[model samples]
Target: MKFEEIDLSPDIMSGLADVNYTELTELQEEVLPAILEGKDALIKAEPGSDKIASFVIPALEMIDDREEQEGASVLVLTPNPDESQQIDELVWAMGYHAQIESASVDMDSDAEEQEEALKSNVQVISGNPGPLADITKKLRYVFRDVKLVVIDAADEMVKLGLQPKLKAILRRVLNDHQTVIYTEEMNEEVKELTKLYFEDAEIIGLEDSSHMLTEPPKVDGMLSHGYIYVPNRMKITTLMAHIEETPTDNCVIFTASKRGTDRLYRTLRKQNLKATSLHGKLSDEKRAQRFANFTNGDVQYLLVADIPAAEIDLQRVTQVINYDVPSNPDEYRYRADLVGSGKASRVVSLVSKQDRSDINELESSLKQAPKELELPEKVKQKLKERKKKKKNKKKSKNKKRHNNGRNKRKKKKKKDELELPRPSFDKLSGGRKGQAKKDQKSGVIGLIKELFS
Candidate 1:
């Protein structure tokens, strides 16, 4: 359904228009009405479902109608600082302001500075429960004013042991406020928490469906999903050759670790390709900058760890290369679905022998093997040639090092011989008389030699 059909305010409608948002996604269309009605809600949605806006729009609309007041009006609790910042940005982009009470921010900053930076009547807070408790004590006024509480990634929060603090926060705000919880999974713990907080709330489930408002473009249609089994050493070479031949405008390569991401970024850049790396090891500012570059078309390739699966939106990504297959079947499905969104035209995964068990489990869980394609002969040949060249280079470097080591040893021996002490005249003859006579004779001879020269 179109967004205009919803009961949002005119100002919000205008804001949506400015952002070019015309219609609602399935989840949004289903849950937004209940949220607008001020009914507590528990929404089950997966990644890439555009679920952020499902609640963000209604929350901002509600806060907009309330009179300006002290303390935050809306509180969004996210799993990590990254998601917290992302929520803040969305709130501000909708012409509202938000504050992120991330642990990274120093505790001594004045509340006014904190409020000003957030730019809204809303505040996004993320931290461990202990530190969060301390910070909350200092901002009792802020908690007192919060009228609505949101918990994003509810399942992850429970897994991270923040459920107790979350429960306490909900209890603290229960007097006259509404609660909304969103999660990708509906496990028992999540179910229990929702039951406790949203005793009489509405539950909205957005199941994976077969409906699409628009068919993806033909270029995206060309993509064939599949897997290949090879030794681990061959995966990188295979991926490099694939990209070298059919270089797409933009691609995202996912690895399991920060080290892998860095290695891939360096290897691709050494081939004279532009690439950037992202992972938890980087500062938030750097990660945001790299994400901006990738989104703005300044960077054509992004080598990242799995952290981006839930956070990044790559609208023009032409390819997704899974350098390492994920261990969890659900995670594999999530990553595959994330990359296969209309944003990316093709998804390519490189599976190795060691990953066979994981792949088999994923296939069984998903109830199907991904479609498979044989490696094109040209690409296969290119990969073989690259491997051969790399092997030869390694051998040559090893031989050169061996030869240099021998030469270095020989030079060291010669220097040691040259530095050895010569037999002394004083040791060969009677000590004092011989030394004095030699010194006088040597002085006279040296003077005569200098005059003659």
Candidate 2:
């Protein structure tokens, strides 16, 4: 269904049309109406599924009706600073005046200035619970007209030890305004939070099948899902070869750790490849800049950790490589779906014997085996050759060192004999001239010859 069909204000509809978002995504189609009706929603949808719009559009519609007086009409709370920035950008791109109050300790000066400038209108506040709680307290007097409070990624916030602070803020806001909670997983924490805040409110659960369609349009002529088992040492080589073969304009490589992400990024860059790294360690500004570069096609490869769970959107990504298999089945599903969502045609994973048990268990738990692909012969051969050559080179270096040490010891013995002092013949004058002198000279000559030789 088109976004225009929804019962929204003409201004909001025109704004969506201007951005060329003509059709509503499945999640948007399912939840927008219920949200517009002022009912509390507990949505479980992936990122890039138009979930943001489901709430943002309706919230904007709600605010547009009361445009005359504004003092923080809408508040969107996210788990991390990165997602907060991304959501704020989405809010702005919709032609709505908004601000992103970074919850991070090191908020960008420019972003802070912009947020301060636009604090009076509909703005998105993103930060850790500590800073947000502080802001909420201060805004109690400054933004007394705040109406809508949204907790995006509610499940994650609870997992990251932000629950208490979040609870405090919610208690303060629930005194007068409405609350909306959105998450990808409906865990116990999410349930508890929902119960505490939206006790008597409506709950709308968008079924998984309803939100994600079965068949997505193909990018090229191929659509495949598979995994391969390889040793740990060969993971980087395998990924490089895969990217070289696929010939895509852009690709994403998922690593399990921040160090791994940086390592892969450095390795790829040293090979003269265009790549960027994204993880929780980076500053919010750096993360935004890297994401922007990747989306704009300035960077061909993006090495990201699990931080892209909810905010990254790359429609033109042609391939996704899982450098390390995710341990959690749900995480595996989420990452796989992120890249495989019709936009990315190929999803390849590098698994090893060590990873097989976990991978098999995950597959069994999920009840679907990702199509398995045989390791390419050339890649296999190259890996074996690399191992053999490394071993041989180490052996040769050790052997040469041993031989050089033995030769040096022998030369040092010869040099010591040549530098030894000789006794004077005059000291032996008391003995019989010819016999004694001949005996002494013979002894000295023999000792010298043995030592020198």
Candidate 3:
């Protein structure tokens, strides 16, 4: 379907033309018409699909139709600051010709600036749910006139534990407002959201499949999957060797934990590799900047952890290196699918002994095992050194623990020897010193009086 056939406003059409957004994707073709008619919808589509445009274009059309509203006509709640900011930029580009005022209230940005933007005659507001919910609590009027409510990346938002804030924002909005949800897959949380918000809505792309399990993720046929078996201790060294030997231009290295991501990033930087790290600990600005660097080809490598694949739009990613095996089949698929750009790409995993079962599960889902790749000699040498180092460290730790135990025992014995018997209060008070007769029952008071005297 083409944008020209739709009844969008001239301004929105012009903006679409400016961005060359003419043809619609399959998801867009199926959902856009219903959305344009203000029907609530639940849509599940993968990343890099034109999912954002499917909703954004209709939202802009809706706001343009209701241009005279007093406050924001559309409210978009996203999972994180980066995703919110990305949508905000898209809104700016698509809404420019129409002169529709829009603001993004990313969670970690300056509060005063967000408040000031909210104070404007903004027709659209895109934001992270937590901050946006807080803002609406203080500034109740910001979303009073909202006609459209969009939860972008709903699955990820739910995963990030933003459902409470999303519900909070929904409660404040007018009950009659249209609600639309977008996600990479249908899950329990997304279902809960749909049940709570929509009476009966159009559910796209999952009619026959199980609502609980996500469709197996898939990449282009050109992408290849491979793995290198190494122990946990040598994973980093193996990763360094692989990057140095592999002629990859744009690559993303995925780690299962933030600590691993930071550790690898530090190692890469120390080796003077053009690399950056993306994880939850970074501030929004820094995360956005680093991601921009990678996307713009300013950096050749990116180390990422704990970030949902749906949250990021991986454009032209030549290679995806799994520094650690993915925890599940869905994860394996998502990471594999990130390798794209019409050219042949690669998904490489470093599987340790503990990760063998995970690899088997991924193979069961993918119906093919990853081709085993030989580790470089340098990585093998590093493996031996790591084993020896770990052994030495363990010996040192045991020796130190043994010495500490002996020292504690000696100190305890000395403390026991130096101890003296505690005297009873009666004996210390001279109760039986023979100062008073046995029949005299004056007790402690009599002893005190006698001592004073």
Candidate 4:
């Protein structure tokens, strides 16, 4: 059914058209009506499924005239700051940026910002559960007024680490209000969250998440995997080599540590490679900017750490590089998930000899081995040529330095020539006396020699 058939607000339809959203994706089609009818919803859709707009569109319509209200009537919460900002983008994408007062609440945000986020007039607030829970606990008056709550990326948020906080926030929300959950899998936390918070909630499960190897929506589509073995020393070099050989158009290189991402980003920059990085170490604004640039194709490559792996959408990346093996095996797929929403051809992971076990775990997770990939003979030869050129360059540089040393000795002699005493016109008469003496001596000697002859 078309969006107009669903009786959505005319303004929302206009915004949807502005963003070229002509028809709803399957997930959106399944979930939007339940949400519009003010029913609790449980959504399970894969990455790149346009799931954000499903909730965002209906939420916008439900509260368009609430701009004059004092407190937020609807709330959307995400697991981390990156996802929080992403939700903010979707809200704006739907042309609700002006009509909806939104705020992002994160642990790193200052108290004043957090307090401002609590404004009842701010109808939409997205943020990490910890900070949101803290606000609900401290400022119940503001959050209790919440009428609709959306938990995006529900499976990840339902983990024990974040579950209690999420539960507490849910408990404080007005019981009469609606709770909508979006998830990829029906994990225990998801099951429990639905049981506890959503009574008679509409459940929309796209596919069985248990058969992860075969059942994920885009897995059977145009996607493949490959691996490369780099001696511990040459991991980055091998990665650079792969990038040099392949199309890195909107690629993501996954690094394990914050420092790894920063180091790789800076190293690539020094080599004049155009890329940016994302990790917890950066401010929320910086991470959003880097993600935006990569999404918009303004930058070619993104050096990222693990937190963003499963969270932010990597739109149509043709390549993904695992710069290092992730600590979690699930992260291997998360990295792959970055590229293979459908169009990814290969996800090349760089595995060092010592860390070969990481690949083993990855295979175990996949239940099979990916095609073994070796550095191409041509690329290898090219790298060797590059190496030779680099070595030759260093030799040439040293030769220049060596020649410069000898040139300094020649220069020293020239400097001595420059230091010779010069005649001053001020001493013209005094300098002539010495010259006249020398001439007299020479003339006397010449006369004596001539007489002897």
Number of the predicted model whose TM-score against the real structure is largest: 3
Residue 342 shift from truth in candidate 4, angstroms: 55
How many clashes in each candidate? 5, 3, 0, 5
Error of 3 at 233 (Å): 41
State TM-scores per candidate: 0.40, 0.41, 0.46, 0.43
lDDT of 2 by residue, 1-453 (tens): 977677767777767776788988777877778778777666777665377777877777777777464446676776666666666666666644322222221134254554454454444444556666665566562445567778878788788888887776666553376677788786546666776765555455643322121222222223466788775567777777766666777788888899898898888899888999898778989999999999888988889885643346555466778788877565565555555445347777789767888778766765456777777666888978888998899899899899989899889999998989886556656646755656656777867866887
lDDT tens readout by residue for model 3, 170-221: 8877647888877887665677666787757777776433323334466555
**Two-way TM-score contest, 2 vs 3, winner:** 3
Alpha-carbon RMSD, each predicted model: 17.4, 16.9, 19.0, 16.7
Clashing pairs in 2: 103-127, 103-128, 229-351
Error of 4 at 29 (Å): 1.0
Which structure among the candidates has the greatest lDDT? Answer: 3
> In terms of TM-score, how similar is model 4 to the real structure?
0.43
Error of 2 at 118 (Å): 7.0
Candidate 4 residue-pair clash tally? 5
Error of 4 at 309 (Å): 36
- Least lDDT summed over 10 consecutive residues: which range in candidate 1? 209-218
